[model samples]
Target: MINGAHVIIYSQDAEADRAFLRDVLGYPHVDAGHGWLIFKLPPAEVAVHPAEGSGSHELFLMCDDLAETIADLESRGVEFPDPPEEARWGILTTIRLPGGGDLGLYQPHHEPAYDL
Candidate 1:
């Protein structure tokens, strides 16, 4: 049987990134060993997208309202690379990570299958 998911975020500044997940985003975590932090994420779902070239899997945070979510995160000092773009699936945007990367965020327009 399947269980919970574990996500690994690679960061240029791993400590700062860990701090962001722990302090900024307020995700509960435990120091496994030697200051290594492991975070617990909220409920999640996965999708498979066809790769046109050399690609990889990704992690995205979904919200009910993109604008409101963006505003709240901005107040917490988070930055976005650009405005949200609308697509058939949702309104999508990139959230700047603490170290030197970005994470995907979206407000889905389709009926959620989270209850499944």
Candidate 2:
């Protein structure tokens, strides 16, 4: 039986990213070994989308309210490179990670599977 999912974010500055996850986002994590921290994500869901190619994936953090979540994150010193845009599925924005990468954040317009 399937139990859980483990997501990995490859970063140029792994330590800095780890600190951001720990101090900024406040995700509880356990150090695997020598400071390799694995974060405990909130309830998660997976979906399949059609594509021309394979071997690619994405990660997006869901929120109940985009504006409120943005405000809360901003107070904690997080940055969003762009404003949120409306989509058929949701309103979405990208969080500028300390590792020089972006993580998707969105408020879903459709029912989310994580609740089920």
Candidate 3:
């Protein structure tokens, strides 16, 4: 069985991205050798939505309180996709990552990928 998968993001400002993931998102992570940082992310839900020529990875994270999460992030100077909308299968919102890639925040309507 597949245990888990780690999505690695390449950023020009890797340190800043690491801090954002750990500080802003409040996810526990570690800095590996050779200037690589690994984030211990929650179980994956959404699949990778690759952008043409961009190579950006899109992930959907399950949240307990979408409203509260959004509020807290916004207060911390994070710019979320204006007017979050409910997609067919989930709530979709976009966040700007440090390296100009868009991060998707989603609360799926179907069963969550992991237990809350």
Best by lDDT: 2
Which of candidates 2 and 3 is the stronger one according to lDDT? 2
lDDT of 2 by residue, 15-112 (tens): 99999999999999999999999999989888787888675789999999999999999999999998999999999999999999999999999899
Better of 2 and 3 by TM-score: 2
Q: Candidate 1 lDDT, tens digit per residue, 51-86?
A: 989879898888999999999999999999979999
Clashes of each: 0, 0, 0
Candidate 3: tens digits of C-alpha lDDT, residues 97-116: 76566677766787775655
Q: Give the Cα error of residue 82 in candidate 2, in Å.
A: 1.4
**Prediction 2 global C-alpha lDDT:** 0.94
For model 2, which pairs clash?
none
The model with the greatest TM-score is 2
Candidate 1 — which pairs collide?
A: none
- What's model 2's lDDT at 20? 97
**In model 1, how large is the Cα lDDT of residue 45?**
84
| TM-score, one value per model | 0.93, 0.96, 0.77
lDDT of each: 0.90, 0.94, 0.73
